[model samples]
Target: MNKQPGTSGLIFNEPLLWDKSREGRCAVSLPKPDVERADLEKDLIGDAPELPQLSELDVVRHYTRLSQWNFGVDSGMYPLGSCTMKYNPKTNEVQAARQGFAGAHPFAGEEFSQGALKLMYNLEQYLAKLTGFDAVTLQPAAGAHGELAGMLMIHAYHAKMGKQRSKIIIPDTAHGTNPASASLCGYDSINIKSGDNGILEPLAVAAVMDEETAGIMVTNPNTLGLFESNIKEIADIVHSKGGLVYGDGANMNAIMGIVKPGEIGVDVLHFNLHKTFSTPHGGGGPGSGPVAVGKTLEPFLPVPRIVKELDSYKLVTDFSDTMGRLHTFYGHFGVMIRAYAYILSMGGKGLTDASKLAVLNANYVKESLKGTLNLPYDYPCMHECVFNDEFQKEYHITTMDMAKRLLDYGFHPPTVYFPLVVDSAFMVEPTETESKEDIDQFISAVKAIAKEAQENPEKLKKAPHKTKVTRLDEVAAARKPCLRG
Candidate 1:
């Protein structure tokens, strides 16, 4: 398998689609309208909207060349901590592209849609079993979308109890989307700082825990790549004040088989099917995040959950107080199809091994780079590891410099300056999919970078010499984005 796709010598100056337009060239030809030309002459035919006109070969070559310039999991290891950016199995894509599933329309009646509904129902049951939830909803399109639905249900639960809870307690180590979800539900987010151990303690939560709090949002294996050992105690404290506990399942890949959030006292949680289940990720893609809940909050899950009727499946909505529909129809059916295929192919043991290997690989890298880099936590990580620029700080080297230099090493850079707890953070997650050889190369590259930083600090300061472009002004790009030419 070639990591870098080769390009042909054929070149056309890389013109934009609009620039390729000619007098009347078109890749498609439409039959003349069935009605007379006079019918559309007055209004519809006044002027033709501007559209690119190109031959079929022209369009194909243009996109193919653009795709060659991009990198994906298939190209190499994408070790972005907390993202679970693992390799997507080609089998999933094959299963998703099957004509029956691909061509099926959502508006088709239940009788014509039995296969589709049954697949959704089966996937929901698999998720419920895995996460120990009473029920699940496949309505949310993505992870953050699932968060919104979960928070809305939490809001509805308290509203039904006649409690006007206005605040949601979130740990500082939780994902950035946690607070945004709470705020979307018209609740204020109260962020509490974690202790020195990078784990959120129950005592710290208890101080901020109050009757006005709607619930607490937490990531079990938090963004710092450390599991919150006091989660059960933290959940108890929140429950004592009659508040729910929402688990952000972004890190579920770390503890998929070893632990279940619902069994561990989480009232509600969501699953990033694309992340944990090995479906396609990123690119504003077709993603699914199914929200699961205990029986207490199950009534408020999005309406029209799938149910089995003897042998057939049906879409039914019957509950106490619902939050209504999050999507017009079942969300991202294609993504769900691919996810279901991944689960059946992997089975139970395979899934367990995936999580175990993820943890093992992360720990291996953490230990290997301990002295060369700066190990901030100095402990076993779940499915990812974190390091600061302590060793590089001596030579005035920064994490950004290290990240940029990784491109020259023939690897995508790990996430930088994140979790916002450690200074000059370098977060890396080598998912279970990578081979030992890939991991070794990553470690060697970092070790070389560390040596370079010590011996010649100037090389670290102005890095990424091998790439087509040198270091970019990210500050300028962020503060003053050029939207259009």
Candidate 2:
């Protein structure tokens, strides 16, 4: 068999840019200023800033080597559960970089920015249709932002009906941020536990859902990667109590064309464009989380909403019931452009196929590694699977140990110790982007590590021997962080 792709090769150790600085070196050559330098106020121009000085080649090599040290979806399989770090088509980036879209000013009048407006309008329409929602606002900046928007709108809906509820029902299986979003909108979170099958039970929801509760926040194909089959019943219960259902579309990659959240009793849904559609994500974003709502919640969507007025689109904020502006401007325009390009490029059929493949890939990983790892939820997963370290307990190994060992085999580790429900959780999600061969290699690497856990358990404790940096004392680092270099 071929060696794993993550095998260490000749790695270059690059020092900090400041460490390589030389007093007289410079990366660029410029002609003497033809115009006189303008004087700046002493306060405006602080003491000449400290900076690194280096030649052009020095700067180039420094960054080039640094890039090699980093791992991304482009580097190898990034099986991060709930984080769809798939390989987005490069064409999406190309479209986003076009001068007209890239250079359009945020403050440009609608007439001058017709193309941008039209794109936004059409993107909203597309998302609305895909999720089976009546209206969509591309204003929330991220998944959590969208959650807050949905909760605020729900609160507003209740207020308009002459009663503002004080609590929202959140299942433990929902996204971790669901409670935080509800709390941000002044609604106390009524936390409910999912049933033994890793999904919310209608009866459990019925037990606490009342007129005092605003609504329920659910993540379809939740963090555990299991679909809540009783969602329709749960939604009916919430609706009967004059409450709405908020769906977290973070895992929309699993059911894009298969099931629309709107048709499933969801009153409001938010799409993580960076996850569901293809867009750059991570590193604190540049993320887009457009919120979609059914007709009941449409009036409270964030404004100024983009509307088409006979061939020309305009931004209108006249709705008195709007949740008000969430972002300074339209959510991340670059992310929107990239997402729009992705949707256009991948028609409905293509997207459905992507979801199917994503689900298939995750199940493949789950079945392949179940023998080597402990799959806490041994049912069919949607686009990810949850595993625990129970099987490795006898070997005196742990999930973190196995995760660190993956680095030595040249593969990025799956998400470890998450979903919080499972002890020593190791969540893996091989998105549709990965091929069977690549996934098999990842499985092999994991199995090899498991074997090592039994025979050479001590070594697993000090794993990732090939990386530039070794295992860190994460606890100490978190407690006594080094604020300065």
Candidate 3:
């Protein structure tokens, strides 16, 4: 495909709908008013809202076009590392949208919503057993929310023991959410740098442990895609210092059935169902992040936990020291339904096989791109692989340039300059759902970009010429957000 050069001004086929509005032109005629209510106070009322006046078809076509511009797992391979943008099975969607599940109100009585409650209860048990944790709470809306809930549980656990721990330790390569969650929970985050090969050493953690340390937040097979082989030692060190171990289970897809965080001595962990389980992720979610805890931290779980009785299930709202409620209702129940469907559909062996295949896919991509890119770590990876821009630096090309050029080839780029540990990191996660052909296509695109970077650096710098939108002024967009049309 020949790529277009330079920018074009915003162009649209239809005139601005606002320009076509007449004083009394209405999209639809309303029925006669049955009753009139008293108007609000003048101060409470704003001037007439400036809404675009468009016919129904105009609005539909505009949104349809906008939706087409979106890139998703359904569209193609999304190699976003740690974000596991895998294909969400359509069957899960069918189950989620079933009237018996989707149409139920959150405020419905427990007795009336037995099926929904049972699904939630069974899901908690399944996840707890799968993760080797004593209890699970599905109150967190997303992975980050789950992290905050886990930290709060840790905080409450220490407070109950009459201990005053004020710091939470996280590896430098940990997700951005780890520190953010700690800060939100009134705990200071102590960042420990990982070793040169992207693994956090046990001794580094042990050296930093003090009486004030709450726990260590570890992301095994961490952001750099290297497993933390010293996890047992690290967990023991934190435990010896009276600090708990918090596992950020964002990368849980890599080790789903192979290992359980609790078995490795992690006291608390958050599961990103949207990432690991086949849940749709977009539009800031509707994501589920159920937190599982060991026996020690079970009492501090969030309120309204589902309890299965003799023949039925019930919701428990009262607790001695619960973390209150992390969400308005049991966090995103429909999302939980989808995840539950995924879990049951996959079964035990299927889950393990999925993990193995995911690891295999990632390794395949890693090995394929090794010579064309700079692999930061030498050892085998889990579900993702990390590469740096050292190979392209000689040509004055950057990871961003390569990423932008990928759009021209009809592929979304891997996450770039992340993990913050590497200089120009390009972390790729070719999920298990992608076929060998899809992987090869991505590999070919990346290889072509690498070649172009050396032969025609300027083309890479002015890349993504085929995308619907060209390069954006990201800094300006952040500073002056234009949210409205």
Candidate 4:
């Protein structure tokens, strides 16, 4: 299988569309005269825009080739850890793109867009039931936004009780956004070290809990791919200190139906619908992150929550002690619709089965590569596996070198040097949708890379030799970004 050249790879060889422009050639010829605007803002208009001039064929072929050069989950196995880039069902896309749902304006009258409102209302209810929470707010745009919303709710809860909790406890193995969100909410973030087994222990959490502790943000089945086995105990300690528990639900794909965060004493949680509920993640603007809160924290949830009253659905604008609106409208409605479709398609049993298969696939990869790689933690991983570069370092190869080499094998590299706790970390997540043959291909690729590292050290150093673009000077690229054509 040959790899497609990405945009970065095409920069050197591909001709710039602007460079192909001709003075008089145009894709379409326009009419000479049209209606003139009597009242227009002249200051806001530019004199002459430097527009590209190309034939229809040139314009069409350029983008078509570029599209073919891109890689996605549909094209191959995307083993991006913590991303859960599984195959998104086309049925969900079809449903979301339906005219009834997609074409409805956000400000349309409630009576005119009853179906969209109904879907949002029902999706909130379904998420609340799924996570065992009292209320759900589908206002945040993405996981990080959801974290901010959760932290704000925590702040509001503390303020309502006349408490001055000023610190948030986070595990060292958690996502980078955890501490950033806590800091954004004006709370001091306290870092707790993971136990020897790669899980957050209650003892470690207890040592950090105090009267000023705002809450603890933990990712179950943490970035290390191991479940926090002592989560219940950790929650107890925080709750005893009169603080709330915020579950970073980014890894919810591993235990969606198997475990509910609210049942384990979590007061608030956020769902990365783009990750766990099968929404297209990249290109940024369209992700949805809904927050679910238990009873104690429900009162402070973000306002403009959907409500069902007397068989009619409507958006509620006012609520006592609400945390206020995080977004302008009811969040990403199209993403929420896709998520609703995904939940309905999976149901309860299917969700549990998917989680089980995800765990099984991760464990299979871990066992297969145990001898070829260095496993930092000797435990069963849930949805992903973590390995370090200790084995490859013997051959003078680093994790970044190995990752770059994998790009030449027609596959996306696993996340490298993440979780910050492990040395030269390489995290791979073969999502549940991959077949055994695909997993075998990945394993074979890694083994072959290891062999190449031992046989020819220089080859790995100048890696991605077969790729259209070789390894870049990352530091230089960052310091001097060439933005203009």
Candidate 5:
């Protein structure tokens, strides 16, 4: 089937590279082998590899066209709540691609990697100061990885105190990774329900805190986009019971310089640098989620922390009660470089402005859609807003249908059916990076969709008429995934 361009002339139905290859076609020229004749491994080697051959232009156009087909934060506004899909700065990209950082070997000696080491060291310090933590670890590779590292450290801290606490208090508003991290550390996740106002209440947490409890895993400005204002009292309750609090810093984008988790009584927290620090996200790989802690959990940090020693910087693996290494190298160095560059570029006041603007933008969008949709929480949201399929459900409309219809309007859908406490949830997070004009356009599109949902219900049911492919049978696709032809 012939497919129309989605954006920037992304031609579809392009032939496979191998399908265009002729037997003798070649894209690159190679010199004759310099090895001795006796070096040929005829006795052990198998058949020669079957490689595709094409002209250099053909190779370039093929990948470039494919990249055009893919949507990214740069391509348009992505309002995915709890994900913080902000525009990654071009300046940060330039910094990350610097020859000094991009070309460094992970296995090279510390003397040869002083600049990279120094960057990492300074980054650790910046994160520590920003989050109000005593120290920070850039070991964990991503947000979930950081969660696992933090949970294990929590387990270790309790174990060192001669207690076998095994239950972790996870609120319903948490990202799914929270309980998974707790379970991975051999702790049972005791799910707690948030209050009717969509924020975690101090009384609800007090009812669950006990001797066997490890701690609470709470996300500030939670999935509902409402801040847990009673965090300090909640933390005190957990601490009074000899437990620790683990803050999931996924929503750190909402509270950058405005609030620090460490000062709010969190013993341990992990920062999603990929989200808050303008690094590339959405792809499965290349993310950084550095964990920071107060003095209590500092001893259990990952091994080989980059430290400064007089004139030179070096790695020190001297922690006696460390959680060991989380990655082979010092996490994703390129990602860290992007994050560090973001910090240096933004500085302290700039970051605070980012948080303020993020909150302002979200409230602006929320006000634009309030009462038109189901405002379940109905309060000021920090960096995102949550709505349910209230009025739309009367017409048999669902969050999924609304999401699919958004594609036709040239807007990516907000996260749907998430933070399960909200019924038929639809969450939107307009990060600080979005301009007021772009936000107004998004608000207009969503309003139009709501109007269309009431007037012509069938349109949403069969949405995305302009894309390369129409609505997909997601259930069938999931149940019978085609791994290969």
Candidate 6:
């Protein structure tokens, strides 16, 4: 109805650095070596590698143009559904870049790096208090890593009781990583389907939970965007059968200060600092997933754990039942610093408000777009909502087509065909960061695309008409990747 944000405008056409390379071009003037050059042995030498030569201006303009084509949460609203791609505050970055935190060497003695140690010590306490767990280990590098640590601890718990369990219970509504994490720990995943209402039913969990099962891995405010209301009962069932409960805290963004997993009978849980704690999320390197556990599993946490004795902080590794090391250093220290900054900045009340606003924003989008999109579950959702192409199916327009078309509207697409249970699922999570106006624009774009599906179905088929790089052959790209050196 209105001029969409994705409408095409002036764009610069640029070429690769190699294509622009010339014989006499040089971006830098290197100084002559002061030391004498020594010849290496023939065995140690290799053929010279080909490299591009370009002017300083050429290199600067090339990268600057490339940056203009990129989009991020800072550039626009990122309703990336289950991912929680919310705005990461710049304050977190500032705190992380501080000299003491950033320059601390991992191999430095505890006495030399007391500031970093103190930060880690206090961060562990903050996380434990937030999640209502007895103790914590900031070793695991990511959510899946945290899950493995949790399962290993669960495995250790059962083994300590003189019997090693063989299986783990995972609900269909749980994160996709749950099964893989369980498998890595040598536990056969007993997958159970969620109830028709889109949440795990206590009866279904009771049927699969047994002494042979190590525990249950559940993603609360599950992938379908519905909360698992029967979690307490399910936890009770698992505990009664001599199994522990492993809560996948990926969706903790939706209930930060409101619900503590430990109080809900979860024995162990992990916090995704990137997802829930305002740390930069994508591009993969800087992620921190600190696992928190109850008294039963605390003894088996990862080694080199931070502790305080009298007036000083220390990293000790003498725990006999520990799960050994999970990272090269004490996890990603920069990510920990960012998360610690976020937690301290938000405090208790701010975190509660964030959860409340996240739920509110998601429901707002759900209610606004349900008329045009087919909502698989009509009930109240937590931090995200799942829609599908049922309404556009008659037009032969699919989820991928609509997602591509959203790019034309100047918005990053919400996750599509996920949570696996719903057919042609289009999951949307508008985190607490977006404004009402921005969300309305997103809703308008989706509704406009739905209208185009009926009026001009072919347009949706050849979608993303305005982007520099249009629709790609994603399947071929994944299967037959072209890696260039």
Highest lDDT among the candidates is held by which one? 2
Show where candidate 6 strays beyond 4 Å: 1-3, 29-49
Best by TM-score: 2
Model 1's alpha-carbon lDDT is 0.87
Candidate 5 lDDT (Cα, 0 to 1): 0.87
Per-residue alpha-carbon lDDT of model 2 for 167-276, expressed as tens digits? 99888888889999988989888989888889998899999999898889999989999999999999999999999999999999999999999998999999899888
TM-scores of the candidates in the order shown: 0.91, 0.97, 0.91, 0.94, 0.94, 0.95
TM-score of 1: 0.91
Rate residue 103 of model 6 by lDDT. Answer: 84
Which residue pairs does candidate 3 place in steric collision?
none
Candidate 3 Cα outliers beyond 4 Å, as residue runs = 1-60
Which stretches of model 5 miss by more than 4 angstroms? Answer: 1-11, 29-45
lDDT of each: 0.87, 0.91, 0.87, 0.87, 0.87, 0.90
lDDT of 5 by residue, 287-308 (tens): 9989999999999999988878
Candidate 1 per-residue C-alpha lDDT over 196-278 given as tens digits, one digit per residue, 9 for 90 to 100: 88899788899988999998999889999999999899999999999999999988889987898999899999979889886
In candidate 6, how many Å is residue 343 off?
1.2
Per-candidate count of clashing residue pairs (backbone under 3 Å): 0, 1, 0, 0, 0, 3
